[model samples]
Target chain A: MSVAQATRPPKAPAGLTHAELNALRADFPMMSAQTNGRPLVYLDSAVTAQKPQVMIDAATRFYEREYASVHRGVYSLSQHATDLFEQARAKVADALGAGKDETIFVRGTTEAINLVAQSYGRSVLKAGDEILLTQMEHHSNIVPWQLVAEQTGARVIAAPITDDGEIDLDSFERLLTGRTRIVAFTHVSNVLGTVNPVRQMTRMAHRRGAVVLVDGAQAIQHLNVDVKELECDFYAVSAHKHFGPAGIGALYARRSILDAMPPYHGGGAMIRSVDFGGSTYLDGPARFEAGTPHIAGAIGWAASIDYLETLDRQRIAAHEADLLGYARDRLSEVENLRVLGNPSERVGAVSFFMSNAHPHDVGTVLDQRGIAVRAGHHCCQPLMKRFGLPATVRASVALYNMRDEIDALIDGLHEVNEVFG
Target chain B: MSDLRELYQEVILDHNRRPRNFGELEPPCSEADGHNPLCGDQIRVYVRIVDGKIEKVMFQGSGCAISKASASMMTDALTGKSVQDAAKLFEGFQAMVTSDMDATVGDEMGKLAVFAGVREFPARIKCASLAWHTLQAALKGAHEMVSTE
Candidate 1:
């Protein structure tokens, strides 16, 4: 077969049948709950994953009896809280295969990117420099660079994604030059669910002597992410995206690079000494995190990670693969229902649109049925424009999702087509 | 709600496909544009008022189902309404999205009643109220409704 004829859609794996998948729905306690008396089919995880009971209880337990302000005080409770807070950070560092000196906790991925942007982007970058990115990045990845560009006189340039939703390696190579300071892009596209080759991208950036920042907001939940293997200079992920709480995130920057960069914010916990002449700053992550940290949120996030660790990573990945493959196959039954991405093994997500039906209308009807799927641009407005679509409806899957849920989604698409046809 | 599916209802599919009054008025009699940069919703409302009465009202924009359908329903309901009466009606619709509406406000804003369900969705209240807010701005002689953030 020729190259044109060689590429075809992959067949669904036979690991989990719809019946078996339906039976396994009890794994998630929330799946048993109802919304307006309808079964809750949550498929908007790219926005933020729903928390498991373990993470919930971690926060609840802390608030109930063990609550105390961390990192400041002589009380025994304060010391315990501080240890838990630091222990969570140490766990986060271990999660990313990084040292404690390399990880800094902020509000979320947006703040993490902003921290690096305001610190390294402003201080080190200069005019004529370019921060390279792919066209398929979320606005969170794009906007932070734009801010730094506006401040430092450096420019923001985009690498193109092929029509099939994978990044164009030729285009990426063309975009990079001596002035390329940082290569920032999403590890996975929120809409298309295309998992980019981070290792290869980092290697390409390294060849050009530029650092890379992978927006792993989607990856950590689906894939086994290791920063050492990826060799990215700065990686960002929102805790909420990985079954954790909102309002807290982690940024992994190489210690050598962070050592040269100054602190972005100034406040309590970040100071070493304060004199009339000048003030000295704390080192490493403490210097970057310059406020009263989210102690409860950190503890809760660690608990979420703990919950995921109880399950087999390989099993979760396989189950998601089965659901995604089955969903893709089932949706193809519709006349004009076209699945967006063409990944060999998709990261358990599907994005598409019907013949004449707008995604917003589809989303509303889905909401009425108590099926929560994200609709519209998925925060990649430029990608939507490139695809010549106003928006798309996306149903992203997690470990808790099953094939029957995917069937519900496919059947819903059929109803949408019948109504609109 | 009967079918556990993510399909748009017949009513929504019809509104989305046809999208009543889905064009800009050439040299619009009175026009105002509003955009929700948060969700990338852009809408422009046009009104041809004669003698303090809205002789004609129409809209053209790109947005979610609630915003577009609400705008279409807005024009259909407010076509020949007196500007003063329409203002009160707009307030009723606003109350539906922003607060609770009494029977008086409810009956007065007929057909627009379809969007009463929007109140349950706090994040989507803005989607249902975008056109009404623009109408309010247009009546006040404002030119545009950009991000108020």
Candidate 2:
């Protein structure tokens, strides 16, 4: 056997074993933290994951020892810093099965989507053209396109979602027409935890001659993402959502499409030559990347990717699926609780409403018991409106989460019922 | 649990369960809408003024217990009070929720002093004060919607 395989633990029949999961949990320092004199049960990973010690250390080590501006000075320290930064880019590209030249570092998914909506959407979209989006899209995905559409006099159209919260394939296909210039949607709904069929949707959009962008903010943590397999024109991911540092993310765009797109922001690093008369911009990813990048954040993100690579992704997916099912079942047992969106395949999160209390009230009670959950529109007000709910209480899971944490959430929810009953 | 009980006291829960003055006022009255965009809490305050006094005050909307109960109790307190007195109560309620936890509430607050617990939970202060802000807008003849962003 290969040395890597030989050293790896024997595969569990279904997900990680109890001891294995506990060992993994120890990697995250926040797992041991206490809130309100009770052990913290972090159930809001979908909002932003608690960082692993490795990622924290990686960023600290870089800032403390190897801090230098990349691609500028001729000194060895600057060269070393450049090498480390480029190595991080390579790791991000490899993680998505994308070309190194096609991956551009951004300030999380919002900036990435805004980059595309401005650079590509503005360049191609015309008056009377349509940019088709799904009802399940986060505000990040929807608002950028709307801004671009308004600028170009192009119309923004939303594809309907089904009662179960899945993007209705039939409705989506029908929305795509010859006038459609772009299609943007999320790989997974942050609130509902519904995983969309990106490959199928990409194929449909391609048939209509439309470029596709997939929001990977909620997907990268749970799924083994391969941009080549999904065949999407562009994909965006936030490092913070996947246990890395905040304010840093990566965008994977197809080589030809990225090559044709103009520079998003104008600054020093993106130029080939500069003069007062006229300046020339470089081709590929650097064209879109403008100011001094987040070097330490990239390093920390690379460490997070390395940490994830050490774990078997399939087993993690299975473990999260089990937790989602358990959460849904337990939430249903509550007398007045109503779990939203019975999507066929869900990951990471489960959103619900209790008839007896508003989500905010339930969230407050849960907070007192040291459980962290999200209680709001989740930045998808349109999606909340689709279900006719003001807000929902979202309990999200990460790899370190255990069944006991879920049980604690259940008990906290019971307390909410008692207080508001 | 004690902290929670402090925040969601029995009076607050009762007011939330069956809010007083819980409907829109008829025409010839001023009304203003309040919205907390973060949590989707919305309250619309309606009032009928007679000789610069609030002859009738009512509200209609959907929100959490804190917001709903605060609105319910606000209408009850504002009835038969002059616009100036209503503004003073708004100021006192806002101070009670925003002040330090141990600060003494003014006697003018009366039953509204229950919201002193909100000082400990800074995030809920906006929820407790959303209706008061709307009520102030209605009293000022500003029909524009107010948002606690």
Give the top-scoring candidate (DockQ).
2
lDDT of 2 by residue, A158-177 (tens): 99999999899999999999
True contacts kept of each: 0.37, 0.93
Residue pairs with colliding backbones in model 1 are A412-B6
As for candidate 2, its clashing pairs are none
| lDDT (tens digit, per residue) of candidate 1 on A231-324 | 8899898899888889999999999999888989988888999888999998889998887888899999999888777765665666787777
Highest lDDT: which candidate? 2
**How big is the positional error of residue B2 in model 2, measured in Å on the Cα after superposition?**
0.6
Two-chain complex of model 2, DockQ on C-alpha atoms against the true structure: 0.92
**Candidate 1 residue-wise lDDT, B65-101, digit = tens:** 6677778878888888899889888888888766653
Provide the clashing-pair count of each candidate structure. Answer: 1, 0
Q: What are the runs in model 1 whose C-alpha is more than 4 Å off? A: A1-28, B2-16, B50-55, B95-125, B146-149
Per-residue lDDT for A353 in model 1?
A: 77
Q: Which lDDT value does model 2 have at A239?
A: 93
Which portions of model 2 miss their true places by more than 4 Å?
A: A1-13
